[model samples]
Structure formats: structure tokens, C-alpha cells
Target: MSSHPILHANKTSPFGDLTPDEFYQKHQVLHTHSFISTNNKIKLYTQTWRPIAQSQAHPPCGVVAMIHGYASESGWVFETTAVAIAKLGFLVCAIDLPGHGRSEGPRGHIPSVTPVIDNCIQFFDEVRASNRHLPAFLYGESLGGAIAMFICLRQTGKWHGLVMNGAMCGVSRNFKPVWPLEKFLPAAAMLAPNWRVVVSGNLVDRSYKEKWKRELVRRCPRTKRVFEHPPASTALELLRVCEEVGRRCREVDLPLLVLHGEDDVVCDVESAELVYELAASTDKTLKVVPGMGHQLIGEGKEILEEGFEVIFSWLKGKIKK
Candidate 1:
């Protein structure tokens, strides 16, 4: 691995004191591997962390289906949080979206969200089938949050609860493509779907609160690394998804927990609040923690733990019901 200080640091890792392999083994998290989506013959990368406390002899309290954000994979940094949930007696499963990480596609090029959502639903269905005795919840971050929202709407009763962290409910105006460029995005998408569309600033730098964490994330060789400018089609599709999600906010009627950083410029806190207010769900909670950014992992260790504490507590209460 590269000689980054964060990678080499002996500080108490959020991953725990043991080595990476040791921690995963202790947590009973299965090593990440590839699976065929069958929908489009695309090989997708998937990973699961099963609660050590629960087996055939014992039963899990619940299962969590996780979806990572845009330009992200389900392995590495994402797995850390999955392991945390598994430690709490829940089966946690995650999938890398197409065109991201180890999944096959033109990097960061999602012409439409339908295929991605369909792949996730198929994969999640398989997970739920295996653990039919347990309730299933959906967890997502950023674009993955949007996917989860769409899934819940399309497949009502498939999920018991939904947890969204820094979700793209509505793209912040500050981060959106400028007016003329936004107007021209559709034509450009039709003309050159795969062409890179550089935004005003890099998302990695803006999203992560810690500089080292950003660098560490960029060091991953499996992903496209640092220079991830969304493609024309991908950008246009994201805009459409945000708009559609906003329009359908009132349709969200399940138990919902929306966690967002108050300073998350990547996905506006205001948009998250709008969803919370508009959603018809009888039970809904929104926590906009102060002084945080889009990437919760980049927040200091204590705040990260605090965020998950809220998530786990909320999940536990829901599962008890």
C-alpha cells in the first residue's frame, strides 16, 4: 500500500485494534466478492457482514441492506460501518453500483437510475430470501440514499425502516452545475453521454472533513482514484433523480431516520429537512449534526461513533416492534 500516514497510523482505528484481516474475521464479515446481476450480465461486487452472535443455533434481530454513494464501492471504507452494524446482531449486506469500484461499466456513467435500482432490488431480494425470518432495513449514503428511497417507493413493504446518511434528496444549489451549463446538460448528454463534465470543484476534497482521509480514499487503486468528474449522462441522470425524489417526497411513508451533516454542501441539509417535513410517514426523524461534512468517516472518531449510535438506537427500537 502507499505510505500514507493514515494508512500507517497506530492510532485506534475505527476498524478496531486488530489488523484489517483480524478485525473482519472477528466480526464474521465475509470477504467481498463478485456476483452476476443477471439483469444485464454485469458482474457486481457484493459484501456481507453476518452477526457472530446469530447463526442457525441463534437468530438475527434484523438484516440491513446497504447501498454506497456515487463514485464509491461497497468494500474498504464502506465495510467498516457494515461491520459495526453486524456487531450489533444484524446481517449487513452491501453492493457496489454499476460503473463504480470493481463493478463493470464505463466509470461513473449511469445513463439512467432504473438499471441500478433494479440490480439492487434483485440483489437485496436474494438476501432477504435467505433470511426470511428476520426483518430487513435499507441503509444508503448519498446517491445510494436516492436508490434506497426509490426502492422503498417501488417495493412497498419490502423494508421495515430506512436510514439515509448525507442522502441526495435534492442536490444543493451551491454544488449544482451552473445555470447555462445545467440548461445545456441534456443536449450534451444526448450528444456525448460518456464525456467527462468537470464541476466547479472536486467532490472528494469538499466531502471529506479530514485531509488525510480524503487522500487515503483517493489512494484506492480499485476505483478511478481522485479525478472522478461525473460523465455528462451521469450528471444529467443525477439531476433528474434529485428532482424526481423531491417530487415524490410526500410518498415516503415508512419509518425513516435521515442523518445529514449540517455543513454538508454536497447534499443540502435543507433538502433533507424538506423530505422529513413532506414525508407522510407517521414516524420520522432528522438529525443534522453541526460541523460535519458529507463523509461521516472524515469526521473525528467520536462524532462518527455518535452518528452510528443514533442509527443503531433507532434501528433497535424499530426492530423491537
Candidate 2:
């Protein structure tokens, strides 16, 4: 019921032209809400769900930070996942990254990875300052996962554990390689950064396919927004971050739970394997859910539930010991 301030200008595209009402109706099924962070210059829009039984008395379980993917806001993509994690007895803080969601920044422009990591650290500090007793964990999806890993490597002991779903360690198929191209492309594009490139070839999951079908019939234009198309220089910066993080995976020493779909087209499954193989943490696990696509958490209720159980069991075992 709380209002989330609209910050960025509504973009115009074949997929980005939906009226506010249509967008809200498409996502009305989930209990979506927002809050502003006092510590940062940006207005942080977050979605939170507590267990029904413990909504009044905050649960004793650890706090879990849910980081969302590129071009997508936390509200639109992470409602179901946040509810699932909260149902497992944890307080969840699912925030829109600086440029996404309702946060303050130019739409889709991530100047560098360091600033993103800094913002994440600030967000975590704000959360801890608000609620001190709950141990915090990192739950990142795709680009958010990559940001979480970077944070884990840079700041030690901040997180009790890490859960990454479809994390992007390196570029997937159809993305340009990061050798000589990486050295100059991002810098050059920044000067003339408004160029838009269509990123195609992403495979659709069944659930998303159905949702897209429904939205199409309803003429819901917002649901058609592409997260990565019209690639800006900032998008290239993200790719560079992925390349750097992929090399630094061995530096992660905390408990890690990595989930990826075998059929993911946005991120290569081998990237997950690489992280599992290189992470310094002995308490690491990788789960490959079958028939799922890039959006593993939103693919289906069954898959989402199963993934949550896996994460819950792991966290419970660790917390118990």
C-alpha cells in the first residue's frame, strides 16, 4: 500500500511503453512494497515479505539480501523469490540496484563495478544498522550474484553465506569476448554511450513464456521490456565486471550455494562450475535444476520451492552448527 516514488523517465520502446496501470496489474499477484534508505543519496526501492506467522514478531533467523538482475527492478522480478526465502524463516531485503528499480541513477547506466560494490556495502550497513541481531546472508541473481561475489571477495566476514542463482561470471553466448575488445570498447562507448544494441537469442522458460503470452494478449507493454537490449556503455562495464569477477572467484572464502539451470542461455553453466571449482570455501555447493532456463527462481512454483528448500536446508545446517 506504500507508494514508491517514480524516479527515472519512462523509456519508450516497442516493449517499454506500457501504462502504469497495466504494469501494476500484471504484478498484482505478489505483495509488493518499497522503502527508502536513509544512508544513501539514492532512494532505495525494496520488496520484503515476512513469514505469515512471524510477521508481527520478527523472526530470529538470519537476514538475507536479495540482489536482482540487470535492467530489471527488484519488485518486478524478485517478489516470489523473496516470499519463498522469507517463508523459510529469514528476514529478506530485496533491493533495486542503483540504476534499476526506483533507485536514483540514469536508467541502465552502471559506470563501474566498484561503485556498485560500494552501494551494496552501504545497503548492507544500512540493513545491519536497522536490525542488529540477525546475521546477514547474500542472495544474488545474475548480475546481482556477480556483485555479491565481488563484495564477498572485497569485504570479509560481512556475510554468513552466499546464494547465487544463474550468476554471470563471464559472458554467455552472443556476447563479445573480453580480451582486446574489453580494453577499449567500454571507454570509447562511454564518450558516446547512448548507442543501443539489441541483445537477442535468450531462450525462454516455460513460466515466463506463459506470462509473456498473457501480457501480450492483455497488451501489457511493460512486461515486454528487454533487460539488456540497446546495450549502453554501462552494460559493457557490467561485462567487464563479470570478467574481473570470474578471475577472482578463488578469493571467495565464505559458504556458497550456487544454483543454475542446465539450459540457461543468458549465462553459461560452465561459469557456475568454474566458481564451484575455484571458490576457496570448502562449504560450497552447486545445484543444476533440469528443464529450467535463465530465470531459475521465477521459472515455476515447484522449481522455486525446491530451490528454496535446498537453500534453507543448507543455511539451517550451518546455523545449527
Candidate 3:
């Protein structure tokens, strides 16, 4: 825990003064990135982080397919956490979803959720191809949480366990647009799918508990996307996706861990609890830390350590690694 990379991060960079290459070397992890074709034209950016190999064979305990939140990429500060997990002896891989990072699409535009789910499945499946002998788990943060749930639902029995960090199981009322606008989103979406809607507050202001950490997100060199509010169609699609996930909670049978901030102003804490309550998985666990906000890892060392420990221990226990 003392060696966790995130602890070393500063407001200016995910690696502070260390170059990306130096950071990976210092942590004793092998980091690599590549692009995978979603089709003949679209290529999704992907990353892999693995513990530096020892003399012994089969050191990796499991494979973790990570999903980052909306308007975020698979690298930057997110990569710091990925390094933290890789050093824990698990294989971790993530992809920049289309429209969010380097992947080509209209900026901040997601007309639907189904294609996003499919894109993740395509990338994650490739990551697990050679590691079939190891247990497979899904780890998602924010909107990634919903994507992870949808993946498990769509490909039942394929995943050994799941982890959701500050999951957007449902939107917080505090973040939603006032009354009639929220009611009119679907109609507005049909009329102008590309138009961005007005939400109550800035997401970054509400997401990170620490001021510097919030600034760090804006400094992300990759992606360069600090999403303010979703376009109408994407906003409507997110609501629909949330509703579907809620309705299918009873169908979630994978070993699950739900980590949420009790005071999260973006995603409702009660909605996460509802998922935990209704999920059919007997092995599920939920930890809603009081006073924490939407982005758990973004809160810096002290606040994040416990939640991260829970995630680490939970993954290790499930695979008995």
C-alpha cells in the first residue's frame, strides 16, 4: 500500500516529475499500448499493465478488464491506478472508448449505450484471449460501472467477479436539470441529438473532494476532455441505460464489489445500494464511505486508500491469489 503510485501523483501530472517510462520502471510493471480495430475503419486505443515477471511461471493471479468513466481515457491519472493494480500481480487492460479519447468519433457524443458496450466487449475479449487459465474480473469506475454490469449481463458466466468504483448506477437528482427540462430530454434529443444540455453543476467541481485533484483532471494531456454536460441524445441514452441496469439487477450473479462515495453528488448512492440489495449474487459486497464524492480515486491518498484496499483484497480473495 505504501508503494501505491497514486500516492506519488501531484496536481500537475499523474506521474509528478517522473516520465511515463520512468514511472513504469520504478513501479516494476511492464506497460504497453496498442490499437485494436473495431471495424474496417475504427480502431480503439488499448493499454496493458503487467507485474514485472519473476523466475516463477504463472505469477499472474487473474485478468482485470478496466472501464474508465465518461469523458475519461484509459491513461493519465487513470493509468496510475492501473499501475497500482498491476503491481498487485493481476493483469490489467483498458481501452479508450470511442469519442472520449484517441478513438475517432464526434467529441462527447454518444447517441446510444449499446455500441459502447459492444466496443468494450470486443476489446476485453481480446485481452482475455491468451489468459483463459486465469480468473477474469471486471472493474469499472463511474459510467464504466454500468458498462461492466452490462457486460456481465450480456456475457453471463464469462466473468469471475466484478468491481464498481463510484459507479453511476443512477444519476443524482442534484446533478439533473430542473423539472421540465429533464422531462423534455427525450423529445429534445430527437430534435437535436448533438445539442449539449444544461445540468445543475460542473461535474469536476462535484467529483473530486480535493481542489488540487480536481485541477489535475483538467490537466489530463490525453483525452483533453473535461465533460461538462452530455449532449441531449447521450443524456437520454444514459438514463435509459441506468433504468435497464436497475431492472436487471436481479440477474447479476457474479461475485460483486460496489464502492461508492456516500456524498457523491453525481451518482446516487441509494441506487448503488438498490443494486446490491436486489442483485442475486450472494457474494456481493457494498461499501459506501461517508463524505466521499463521485470519483473515489480522484480524492488522493488518505481518502482513497481504504476503498482501494477493499478492491485489492476483494480481487485477491476471489481468485485466492
Q: Pick the candidate with the highest lDDT.
A: 3
- The digit string of per-residue lDDT tens for model 2 on 1-321 reads 111112111223112355444443333322446666545466766665555455346554777887877745566435445654565676677777776767777666666767777777776777677778777788888788899888887779878899888888766765543356546666657676766544444323322433542233223232234444534576677677778877899989999999887777777788888988999998899998887666654445566456556767786776676
Please report the TM-score between candidate 3 and the true structure: 0.96
lDDT of 3 by residue, 119-180 (tens): 89988888788778889999999889999999999999999999989887899999987789
Q: Considering TM-score, which of the candidate structures 2 and 3 is the better prediction for this target?
A: 3
Which candidate would rank higher by lDDT, 1 or 3?
3
Better of 1 and 2 by lDDT: 1
Give the candidates in order of lDDT, highest first.
3, 1, 2
Report per-prediction Cα RMSD to one decimal. 3.9, 7.0, 1.5
Compute each candidate's TM-score over C-alphas. 0.92, 0.77, 0.96
Cα displacement (Å) at residue 121, model 3: 1.0
Best TM-score goes to which candidate?
Answer: 3
Sort order, TM-score high to low:
3, 1, 2
Q: Model 1: residues >4 Å from true position, as ranges? A: 1-20, 28-32
Q: Write the per-residue lDDT of candidate 1 for residues 1-321, one digit (tens) a residue.
A: 111112222223434357777766765655445576648888887877776556678777898999998867887567677777777778888888887878887777788999899999988898899889889999999998989999999998778999999999888777877678888999999998887877766788778777666766676666645236788888999999989889998999999999999888788889889988999999999988888788776777666666767888898898878
Q: Would you give me the overall lDDT of model 3?
A: 0.86
